[model samples]
Every structure is written in structure tokens, then in C-alpha cells.
Target: MNNRKYIMLDGKVIDKSITETEFVKADKNYLYDSFGKRYLDLRSGLWNTSLGYSDEIYFSVSKEFSRLMNKKLAYLDIHSFDCKLYDELSTNIISFVRNNMKKCIFTNSGSENTELALKIASAIYGKKLNVLAINNSYHGSFFGGMSVSGIDIDVNGRMGKAYEKVKFIDFPDDIISEESMLTWLEINLEQYDLFFIEPVLASAGVRIVSDNFVNEVLRLCKEKNTLTVFDEVATGFYRTGKPLFADRLKYKPDIICLSKGINNGISPFGSVCVSEGVLVRLEGKPIYHYSTQNGNLLSVSSANSVIKYYLKNGSLLEEKVGKIETQVKKVMKLYPNIVYRCVGAMLAIEVEKQDIMRLNTILKDLGILTYFYNQPTNGLTILPQFNINLDVLEKALRIILNKIS
Candidate 1:
């Protein structure tokens, strides 16, 4: 009946043509219906928007870029403020990753970064074309990302069959066990060009693998010359309490995928941190994967500012999550059946198995929104923004658990 509703339906039809995922009502940290019912942005823009809702730096930078373009915007190809901003952002990015990660390449979304990382791996090691991704991890919605995404509950039947070149290994969980994972890695990683994974499984309900296990995998990847890319789209920019939760684990990746928080949710730009091994050959011949909007000056400038903010408040970000982690585990212990998965800033509440969908719907009515995740582990993800007020967060969690019971 409403034009906005009609447009939303049409847009979904269009987007669904490309991918099976759809969106709910969202503008900033809040999503509203056509009727204008506001919902607390519990999921934080599908795990982006670390700063959440009307980020001042994004607005400020966007206004400046908009005003500059109003005067005389040069060809993005020609280079101007846009190019300078990207250079600065790259420098800021590389400084951290370079010391540990090695190199960086820009992309338009996490999926692009994932695909590009795979491409880089293929370009570097043609003999080992297979890329490994952890079972139950979510990277992106694109075909490449979907192919590597082992998140679907019935992916094999739904996606027809995974691409032969990409292998999905059962990522470690309480049930899977570390010894089983290491044996699996030892057997499969030798012939892989790239092995993609999340340091802490996010969509599959934030199950964290131990740092010791992660470092061992990295060692194996290095020995096999497999490019290991840690998909850090959710974990980056303080969501996981550190730039790379790998740092928390003391394991370094050859490539680390980043997005979501890159521009603080003002704009979208994704990047893959490349290691020295991959960058050394870039000068030999040009690698030609480019997006029209890749590293646009406006987004890059916003990203640089966002990183600056993260640097200043990084400790606080971790501290908040750290406190929440300790508190939730304590609270959850009081109600273990209701809260199932726990790792870092993300956690999942499991009510009666039959009541999962009802629990999700009821929580949305209670103002906290979460998604049905059937990957790596079948559970919902509670990825609140890094800056979500502690009181509001605890209240939300209480609401969520109470609604379920």
C-alpha cells in the first residue's frame, strides 16, 4: 500500500536475484518498519558499524567531500583529495599489518576482499589451487564468498555443490576437538593455495579457537606455502577487542580480510592485508583487479579517521568487551541452557530448540534484533556495536533472556 514498502519489496527482488540474503528495517543503529516501529540495532549493521548510528567523523568527512565535489571534483582516475586520502589510509593500515600482516589491497566489500585474496593465492601458487575456509564461517554473500562460506545448514543441497577448488574443514568447537582439527589441517593444507578462516567464528556464534591452535595452523600454512587469510570482517576495529584477534592469539595471517568498520559504517570499503610473500611479486607484472569505487577518497578518508578513533579508544573497546565477557559468562552460568555460545563481544542464546524462531521474533519485539544463523553452529549472533552503552547492553541481554523464558 505504501510506496516505500513497494520499493523495499522491489529492491529485495532485485538483490535476491544476485544473492539469497535479504535485509530488515535499518537506517543507523536502529531499524524501523514501514509503520516506524524502532528496534535497537543489536546486530550492528550485520556486524559492521562498530561506532554505530550517525558517526560524527563519517558525517564530517562526507560533508567535506560533498562540498569539494560541488566546487570541482576531478576525475577519480586523475587523482586528487580522493587519491591522497586513500594513500594515507593505506599507510595507516599497512603500518599495523605490515609489521605483522605485510601488505594491503582495497576492495568494495568483504566478499570482494575474500575473492581477491583467493585470486592472489591462485596467482601466487597455481599448483595448489584449492582454498580452505573453516566450516560454519560467513565471509560474504557473493558467489565466491558463498562458495567459501560453510555457514549454510544445508549448503551442499542448496548451493548444489561447493566449488571443487575450495575445501571446507570442520573448524574446532567443543565437540570437534583440537586434535581432530590439527589432523584435518595436516592432511588437507599441504595442497592449498589459500586457507581462509575467521580467528573467532562470528556468524556461527562466536566460537573462538585457541591462539595455540591458530599459531600451529599458521605454521602449517607457512610450511606448505599456503596463503592463510583470516577473515576478520567482524573481529577487526575492536569488535573482537583488538585489531586482529590473531594478535590476541599471537598468530599472524598472510592475508586478513577487513571491512564493516572500515569507514565506521559511513561508507563501504573492504581491504585484504597482504603479506610480504604476496607483495614482492606485484612489481613483476600488474595485477588487474579493480573496482570503480575501490578506495574512493571519501571512504578512505573516513576509514583513516575511524582507525584514528580506534587507536585512541582501542583499550576502552577491549575493556568494555572484556567486562561484558566476564559478566555474561557469570550471568550465563546462572542460566546456561539459555545462553549457548560465548566468545569475545559476540554471544548466542539458545532457548528450547523448538522455540528458537519464536525466541528470535519475541526478542525483536523486545527491541533487540538478531538473525537466524545456521552455520559452523546453528545459533543466533548477538554482535552489538563496540560503543553500545553498557547499561543498555545489559538491559538488552536481560530482555533477550527473559523473553525466551
Candidate 2:
């Protein structure tokens, strides 16, 4: 037997001898393994597949792009020249965000977008750079992302001393009053070149920060003339029942890092949507960054379809999520031991740390897959597809509640 495992799971190489179940097919919201057993993927492809597997919009878009590629009509390299798909994608993304996003820079993934945003920030600041981020927040895996990330920055001392300028402050908490938060920012925001934040800290057990706190952060950044970047990679594209979680904010972010649902997980694609101010500052900056797959035509086409799908069905989907939230709250009242939070289609139910693994395994055996974590909070996170069937979700919830009860 070959001892070499060619794949890494969760940043560690897995033992090759340990066979894993393979998902051979997918339905609306369920994945089918080779044994023909089906499991509901409540995490929605790591919260990227908002429309779910086998969605008609996704299928149609994919088919169209495949045909175009076969005809050799849509091959485009971002480094070369812009194409019609690029123009349309930019227009739709700008309108979808419906904020101060004046320009869009395409990238390969969320990590790449984070790195590019930091590069742009570095260009604006030129040499001396200080970044302030909230504790328990995750940006991505890139060096710049890891630096700004409040969590996992010092994992095994891997980040090194290259990002000493990046600092972290406590996320807004009950113990830390609003006054204290403002005072700290008022005195220190000026020294920082950029402030990175996630409206909802997905990796931190789906913790949603208060709107007032986010707005205050923006106000202080504005007052101090510091750039604010909203890391919306996980919370963007109608995740919080809004176009972007930033939509709920009082002030617009200078730069918005977007990915995940941008293309409905159809491709490795992401984008940095910049405000007019940030765009102006980026002009003439010798920030040389390029990727052959940055503006792939197929990704652009899929993104266009995703934007259209949201525009057409966003209201109905949001209504469904609202009903689901209400239903879950009612059930949660019965279980005092469980602490849970729901924002739109996203949900987090915290349980005892000791029970984390047991519950996750039980759920998996019962044919329900969710995102689970034991850090910051021990809980199971459920992010159902926006177009998920309510009755199906109700059944799944019942099973989960019964098992926990």
C-alpha cells in the first residue's frame, strides 16, 4: 500500500490507507455518495453554494459558457484586454453591491482577493503600514490575510515576524462597552493604514457583530483618514438576507473583498470591489500583480448568472430565510443549554465542547452535513442554500433538535 497521501484535509496530510466516502452526485440540496446514500449539505458547499446543487440557473450558465468555450469565442485573459463578459460582470457586481463600489479587480479566490487588497493598501501607504483587525476574525490563508486575521495568526509560529505591523483589538463584547471601543479607536485608528473587518465572523462560529459597532469602526476610520476594508468573502451575496452584509452598515467601506457566493462556487473566482477613493489612490501605483486565471471568461459568465438569480429571487429567498429563523428560534427556546444565533440563512448553535464531535458525527450519520467548529465557540454552524425547501429544512431541524434534546 502506498503510504503517500496526495491530498491534504484541513491543512494536514491524511493517511492514504484510510478510505473516505466520495460524493458521486448531487440533487437540489443533497449529495449522494457512491453507496447511493444521500446527505443534506446544510453548509451549502462551505456557504458558497447559495442556490444549491443542480440549480437551473447554475446549469444554464455552465452550459452556455461551455458552448462558448468550444466555439473559441469567449477566451479572455485579464492581462491582455477586457472582454464583454468582464464589462457585464463589473456592471452587475457594482449594481449588486449597490454602494460606493466604483471599480472591480478580479482575482482567483478569497485568499487572493485578500492579498490584493492588502497590496493596494500597501501601495497607498507606501512602506510604513499598520493594520487593525478585530479578534476572532478570519481573513484568509495568504501571508497578508493571515497577518490581518485575528485568529490563527500564530498557529505553530508559521506566520513568522513578517507581519509585526498588523495588530488586533478585542471584538465588541458586553464587557467592553461601546464607549471603550470608541475611545480605543479614536486614540489609535489614525496610526493604522487599514482596518479589516468581517461583518459576520463566520469562522469564529458565525458570530455577527452589532451594526452600531461596525458603523462606529467606519466613522473612526473616516475621521482618522484610514482606509476600511470589509472582508465580505463569506458574508457577501445575500448571505445575511441582504446583497452584502455591508449593505446593513451606516457607512460604506473603502474596499470590499468578495468571493464564495459571487459565482455560486462554480469556479475559483473572487473580486476586490473598490470605492472611488480607493480607485483613485491605486492609479499610477506600481503595485504589479497579475494572474492568468484572474478574469477567466467562464467565471465572469457564472457571476453574471448569479447576480441575475439574486436580483430575480432575492426577496422570496430572504422571506424563506426569515421563516426558517423564526422556526429555529421557537425550537431553541426548548433547549436552554444550547446558545444559538441566526442571521438570515446562516445559523450557529453552540453546545458543550465535549459533545461537539459526538453531535457532528451523529448528524453526519443521520445524513445531515454541517460546518462544525470547537474554537471560539463549540457549535454546529448551518448555512442552508438560499433556495432550500422549507419543509425539508424543517425535517432536518427536527432531527437535529431531537438528537440534541
Candidate 3:
């Protein structure tokens, strides 16, 4: 066997011989490898393709790109050019998030959007760089994003020294009291300039924080002048049974970082939705961040199409997600040893530590793609498209249950 010529860096040393060939085609909620094996994409292409593999988003974006081919517009310098596409896209994005946020800044990835939010907070509160993040939560993989992330990833090497500025707090587990949490924040709140959160900790075993906890945290942050930034990169765009998980909270964040499902996974794009108060602070500030693909025409158009799609069919999507959640809960009841949690289309199933690898391999062999969490407890995360076929999901679930049992 000639050693595989490609040098792919996935941070894992898997047996290349057992790996399947490259995927040749992707239809709705499924992928076909070169050998013609069909696999249900339960992870929704890293939880970004809320509308599944093939949708009208592809057609709309292609049509727009064909009309405006090769139009390059950078975020910092686009003001000089008459970029009507940029303006139209920005307006559409603002409309989607404007109920809780006032302005939007585009980026190419979730990490960049998160990093930009941190920079904006720093710019607003100079000299107060302390940030509060929850343990076991994940924001992204970039420097700023990793700094805020509480996962045990190997980020403390030479490049990870920047994470020293971030202080992590324990996530409110079941036994922790609200009063205790409030007291802890009251004592330590003034020292931090920003508090980053994932409304539903999707990467952290799909843990959903209580509304009371979220409301109290926002209240304390307000009292101490600490800016709140919701990293909704994983939970936005109907992933959590709402347009944004923050919609369920009583308090609105100063900044909300969104990505993943914005363009239904058609493009790599992210955005930071800022409140009017934060925008005022950034109004006259000189540019501190720039990316070549920031507000790119194709990405913007795709994102616009996704938002419009959601606006039109949001109610139906939400209803379908509710049905899926009910099905998941019922299946979970069949196995007492198995523990699970779900929010809209996202689900996390926990099994014994020893069986983690075996279960993952079995699920993969059964033609289901899933994600695993980096936690002490073995957790498999599933985030299917909002409108995933219930029949397909039910079949996959039965297969998973049978293997685990």
C-alpha cells in the first residue's frame, strides 16, 4: 500500500487504511462516498447545515454569485466602493438579530467572530482585560476563542500563553445554588470586563443553563459594568428551538457571536451582533481587525438567503424540531444506563467511558456520522438538520439503541 500522499491534519492519528474514500456526492441529510456508500449526516456538517445538504440556499447563492462575479469587498475599506451587495446583506443580517442587537460585523469563521467580540469589549473598556468564561464550554479554536474556552484541549503551549488573561468559572451544575452563584459573581464581577457564554453549552455535553442562572449573571454583569457576550456560534439559527437561544433569556447580551448555521453551511462565515450601546463605543474607533474574506460577496449572499428562508419557514422548522426532541426523549427512556440531553436539533448521548470508542465505531459503521465531546464522560453529540426526515432519524436511533443495549 503506497502511503497516502496527502498530509491531512485532523489532530488525530487514525488508521488511514480503514478510512473510507472521499465523498463524491451529498444529497439531503446524506453523503455518498466514492464507493457509493450512503451515510446519514446526523452532525449536520459540524452543526452548520441547518437546512441539510441540498436546499434552495445553494441555488440562490449561485444565482447571485453568477450575477456579481469576482466582486471583492473588504470590511475595513468597502466604504470607498459602491458595494450594494454588502449593504443589502448587512441589512438582512441586522433584521434577523436586531430585536436583541443593533449592528453586525462580518467575519470568515466562528473563531474570528468570537475574537472580534473580545476585541470590541477590550476597546470599550480599556485596561480591564479580565474575562469570565464558564468551565467545560467551547467558543472556538483561535487564540481569543481558545482563551475563553474551558475545554481541556492542549492550548497551553507557546501559542496559548495569551489565555492567561481569561478566568474560568464552574458551570452551574444541578447541586449548585443560585444564591451561591450570585454571591460568587458579586465578589468577582468587578474585576472582569467581559463575560462570554454559550446559551446552550452544545460542546459541553449539550448542557442547557437555567434561565434564572442566565438572568442573574446578566444582572450582576450589568451592576458591575461587565459586558456580556453570548457565543451563539453553535446554538444560533433554530438549533436551540429558537432563532437564537438568547431569545429565551430575560436579559440581552451586549454582543452576540453567531456562525455555523448562518449560511446553512454553504460558506464559511460568522458575524458579531452588537448592541447599540456597544456600537456607540465603537463608532469613532479606528479599525483594529481585518480579514480578506470579511463580508465577501458569496458568503454574504448565502447568509442573506438563509435568513430569508428562516423568516419564511421558521414556525414549521420549530415544530419539526419539537417533534424530534420528543422522539429522542422517548428513545432515551428505553435505556436506563444511557443519559441524554437535547435542545432543538442538537442532542448529546452519554455512555460508559470504556464503551465510548466502540460505540462511536459502531455508529459510524452503521452509516451515521456523529460528533464526540472532549469530556471525562463519554458523550456523542448529534445535530441533525432542522427538517431532517423523522424516518431516517428514527431508524438511526433504533440502530444506536440496539448496539448500545
Candidate 4:
């Protein structure tokens, strides 16, 4: 009975009044609606807009892209004609993250990259193997990703469960002691062909994985010849005020999946970085894992610019994020009734009677936009641009506290 005049979403024509938040334009730090009402973007476009809406990098990349197109020097696809920029960007990314990764394969999104990482692991092992993923973790939206995700997804009253080979284990929690968890992992580690982890567990209320757990997992996986894939899709590219959350660990992961902040939310881009051993294993094999726009010039140019920006100014961003973290800590101290977790540029705020959807709407009405996480905990994650105005953010935090407290 419902027919939308123009747009069709989710296979149905939904009512227009369902959501009021509309964005017509955006600039550094804020999005402006049609009525010219500006809302500070706190989720950073799902934690990808690390460089904000507008920046010199964007302008420069656009100009470069235009010039390349005009000269017919820009090939849209990586497979068309090997572009040197592809390898250049990949090298720089590997260098920038400072991880001992060997090479990267470009993809269009985090989901694609994560799925691709899984494929790579399967291909290298040359068999169908079990996948071990932490409970409450989110890899991506693809079928392979959905299968391993900790949060149960249901479609038409049927649970969209993980693959038969996928197994879920509890993250180190109050009920599951770290020692017991380690013991369990030690006993059952070898059964898995791949072990997936989100360094910060961004979707799981910004839950940070402890060093001991990560180190133990890495050691066990290494001993078992299982590939440890770090799904840094959300925690990568300085979102955690560090180039990568994996860097803080005692050992390196076998593979690292990256996206989001690489292009500062300008282009659809992602890269799956693997260690030297993986690259060698698949060197001569026929690997069927590439899309037409896998290494499109638009994404490559934007990634190049973003990588360059971070290389030149990572320290400044770290300093700014440190200050913001301090301010948030102060706010948390003032409101002892609420719960909060902050690491680098990501912060989560929750209350006893948490209704994240309602709180999200309240924030939108208050001219502050954010995204909420559901599962294990209901909370709002404050993921602002690295260059967001400190005063504006401080005020917004107080406003959020006023509602929750």
C-alpha cells in the first residue's frame, strides 16, 4: 500500500517523517541541514571522518584528480594499467602503520577488506578451516563477515548465524576470567584456521582488548600456524590516537584489515595488509579476489593525500586527542552516576537505564549528531574529527551528561 514517489530504501518505501536529521552540506567539524541548522558530527561518519568534512587534503586531491583526468593519465581501475601510485600508496600505508606487514590489496570498503582477509587466510591454508572470533565483535556486513560477527543478526525471525566453521568465544569479561580464557584458548586454538579480532571492539561500546589477551592470542595463533587477522576497520588510522591499536600489542598480527579514515570519508576505500609469509604463499596461485574499482584513482589519490597528511602531522593530532581525552575524563569524574570508556579519539557514554535510540534522537535534537552501539552495552560513542573544536566538544559532552545524569 505504501509507494514512495522517488526513493526506495530497504526494498520498501518508508515514510519521510521517520527521521528528521538531514544533511545538505558539510564543512570541517559540522554538517549543515537544509534549514542551515548545523549539527556537530560526533561519530565522524561512523568513525571514518578523522580529518573532518573539509581539509586541504581533500582540495588538493580533487585538484590532482581533475588534472590527471584531463591529461588521461588517471586509469579508473587498478587492473586496467598498473598504476605506480597504487604501490606507492600501499607502501606508504605499510610504513605509516609501522607494522611489519608486507603488502596490501585494495578494496572498496571495510566489509570487503575484512571478507577478503578471510578469503586470503582460507586460500593460504588451501582448505576449509574453522574461524575463531571474539563474542560481541563486528567484522563487516558481507556474508562472511556476518557469519563471524558476535552480535546475532536476525532476518524474518530467523537467526543469521555464523558459518558452520565459525566459533564465538567470550572476550575477557567479569564472568570469564582472563586466566580461564587463556587456558581455553590454549586448548582449542589449533582447531581454528583464522582468529579475528577488533583491536578496540568499536561496535561493542569501544571495549578495549587487554594486552595480555592479545599477546597470548598472538602467541597461540603463531604456534598453531593460524592467521591472526586484526580487523582495524574502525580503530585504524589514528582513530585511537595511535596509527593502529595493534601497534600497542607485544606481537604483530598476521593480517590487518584497514578502512574508514584512510580517505577521511571522501572515497570508498580499504586495504587488507598481510605479512610477508602470506604474500609468498599466494604469489603464484590464482587468487580470484578483485573488484573493478578495487584500486580506483579517486580512492588512491584520496588515500595518498590522507597518508601524507598523517605522516606530516601525526604528533599534532595525538596532542589534540590527548587534551580531549583529559577533558572527557574530567566530565566523567563530574558525573559519577554514568559509565564511560575513552581511548584516544573514541569515547562511549552509557547510563543504567540505557535507551540508545532515544538518547541518539535527543542528541540529534540538541544539534549534536552521534551513533549508538547495541549489544553487550547500549551507549553512544563520541568519535569526533581530530581537529574538532575542543570548546564545542566540551559543551556537547556536558549536554549529553545533563540528559543521562
What are the lDDT scores of the predictions, listed in order?
0.69, 0.81, 0.78, 0.81
lDDT of 3 by residue, 253-296 (tens): 89988898988878788888888888888777654888767856
TM-score of each predicted structure versus truth: 0.85, 0.94, 0.92, 0.93
Candidate 2 lDDT over 1-405, as tens digits, reads 256546555566555422255789888999899999999999898888877886687677878788778888665777888677788888888888877898898888998887898888889878867888888888888777778788876552663734568788877655367569888888878888898888888887888667888888888888899999998888887778778888788888999999999888888889899999987887888797898888778777888888877778778767776776776677678777777887877888877644777787788888998877666778889988866777788789778877765
Return the TM-score for candidate 1, rounded to 2 decimals.
0.85
Worst 10 residues of 2 by lDDT: 12-21
Error of 1 at 334 (Å): 2.4
Q: TM-score rank, highest first?
A: 2, 4, 3, 1
lDDT of 1: 0.69
Better of 1 and 2 by lDDT: 2
User: Could you give candidate 4's per-residue lDDT for residues 7-41 as a string of tens digits?
Assistant: 53432565553345678988989999999999899
lDDT at 55, model 4: 59
lDDT of 1 by residue, 1-405 (tens): 323333233213432221222345455467676667777777777777667775465566667677657867522641223466556778888764443766677777887887787667666654436777778788776666777877743554565633556777877765358878888778877777778778777777777777778888888887777778888888877676566676776457777888888777667787888777668755464345767677466666567777766666667777887776776677666665665776667777654454566667777766677765654335567877665676777777777766665
Stretches of candidate 2 off by over 4 Å are: 1-5, 15-19, 353-355
Q: What is the clash count of model 3? A: 0
After best superposition, candidate 2 residue 44: deviation in angstroms? 0.5
lDDT of 1 at 179: 73
Q: In model 1, what lDDT does residue 41 have? A: 79
131: Cα error in model 3, Å: 0.7
Model 3 global lDDT (CA atoms, 0 to 1) = 0.78
